[model samples]
Target: MRKSNLIFIFLMLIIATSCDNEEAVSEQSSTEFSSMQDGLITLKSGAIVEKKGDDFYYQSDMLLSQKQLETLNEHGDFIIEEPDQIENETEIHPVYNIPVEANEDGPAVPRAFGLYPTPYNMWAMVRFVYAPNLTADRKNIIQQALQHWEANTNVRFYNATGQPTVDPVYGFEYPYIEFVNATGNSSAVGRIGGRQKIRIAAWQATSVAIHEIGHAIGLRHEQSRYDRDNSININLSNVHPDNRHNFNKYTSNYFAVGSIDYNSVMMYDSDAFAINPAIPVMTKKSDGSTWNGGNVLSNPDRSWANNIYIPYIARSDTYRELAPVVYKPDNTVMTPSERLALQAQLNNGNPNPPNCCRLPNNF
Candidate 1:
């Protein structure tokens, strides 16, 4: 079967948000929630998602949609490829609002079919809004995290606060992220469609916001790498059974870039999901000692973001040419001369650029 869009491995859980209501889901411990009335949704492709209330979830926090679940039911095999191989024959130039037809079935993040392959899902330029109910403190934390990403990677976040969620001229609903307050932190693995949330709690640190944004932008927990066994050994015995799935290694279907990163903000600490907080549930294979995962974006994290995204300036006009001022993935701004050179390469120096463009202030 054709592979779906690329990237991510899984962490975090989001409570189902209704179409009209943005109320946060009650903060319930994952262990307790797992023991609550829940149903396991097993797909024909052998993918499993947990159904609690009206939402479906994979691993801990990556939300799964019914359409994505249906796609999984139709196709099964997904091969993990290197980062360079992500732009294979099937891959297209990352563009805004372009439709991509592919099956989204498999693990979350990093060179896999699991990511929503549609251009709208690819986050050409990350656009976000702060929920009105969000407090100033949480907003400040989010801003700090945003600064960290901008400083380290090519990922750019446009603050769409006080902006309309729809395009006034074209009447298309714009895809955008909304930062909302919740009891516990959770976010959809990648862009799942319109208005996905990055739920933050009062107790979370700026580092936590950074991590959730990683998920929102399509980076999964570092431990979910299928080859994680080579780097760290999981002590399933010490883990709570309901939360054990959080530590489950991804299959070959999910791809990764570079070796396992202990310092990646995406990684879980050694005691993550541990039944006894003081007991270690994971340890480095080489040393047999637990490690505290890092809060900053590691080198691999920066490389991954740089590889997958290109910064663009949102515009209202239907100008398809690369923006005159674009940001490279290495946190460097491209010169106008360089932008024109790349634009020439992309459009064959066509005077008339494509007509479809990311609309300004849309979502």
Candidate 2:
């Protein structure tokens, strides 16, 4: 039997320059990979990545920061067996966790592989700033994407445009995301600490912004799950040589939350990286069907976010305030009474705890 595309792969970079012009550029043609050249580097974990220009990449779209490279270098352990299980109604969300290092924040809890962990890497509320140079269209795309996430999941974003990067009163730097214009779309997987960029191209849609934000909040490509061969098959020969690495699967270290979700915004479309524009690079194993990559959060996608993130009012106060809207793990809004009860549970039996500062109006 020819070897399946069940391969373990990592960082692969594609370099392009950022453009500040207000006009939206036309989308890259289907043969966009034809002119690409990439550089490769191997990390401490034996995962090889592509280094292009000044940035390192994982799976071509996820930008890797120096700190993220270090974290991957330090730990390479797995907690679960290979997930041969398929998606069922009761599917459990599988996430990656590393042994915690001693730090002021408690030991890292089990989180999605490359997730921003609590009290440190994790955001109290995901803060963001629009790049001053971003065109109006790009900014609007970002705003639409942000609204989608807030509507479906417990994750909330604070508009910190024109705000200082540091807490003016406390003198501590804030971890935030900046939406910038680039020739291609990409974002760091999870929070890479301090300030990170989510690069959106002029021609990309709001869905692309949604996808990159999913990465910034710690989700990997659904198709990259280790056991995805059971759900879909890759036509390796049909893929571009440089882009074949994009179809590589995650090993045991990266866990799957549920069965392969065809609707996952993190999934690549049927023709992604295809050598022939009309031929599919991915097809369903069950029926040989081709599916489009998701444009919005699916049920499993919302469930994954709700499982990991807590909605909070962004503030510099000693006391943490749960946002008025909280989503249950089932992606349902909690009843007012239930929300109050949970609020009390989070705040030491005080449903209406005193907040240190005024809550921002944006939330």
Best by lDDT: 2
Note the Cα lDDT for every prediction shown. Answer: 0.61, 0.65
Pick the TM-score winner.
Answer: 2
Off by over 4 Å in 1: 1-48, 69-120, 318-340, 343-363
All candidates: TM-score? 0.69, 0.75
lDDT of 1 by residue, 73-188 (tens): 44532212222334322233222112233233222222322332333345656779999999887888998999898777767777788888887987655667899997778777
- List the lowest-lDDT window of 10 residues for candidate 2: 7-16
Residues 1-363 of candidate 2 have per-residue lDDT tens digits of 111100100000000011111222224521232133558655567665677766667788888765454444444311122333322312223322322132333332222222322223334467899888998888888888998998899887888888899878776566779999999899987655567899999967889999999988878888777668978989989986667768766664343443588888888899998889688989999999999978998876786777566676766554446778888655778788877766665555678857467556452
* Model 2 alpha-carbon drift over 4 Å, by segment: 1-38, 42-46, 70-121, 167-172, 252-255, 353-356, 361-363
Candidate 1 residue 208 C-alpha distance from true site, Å: 0.9
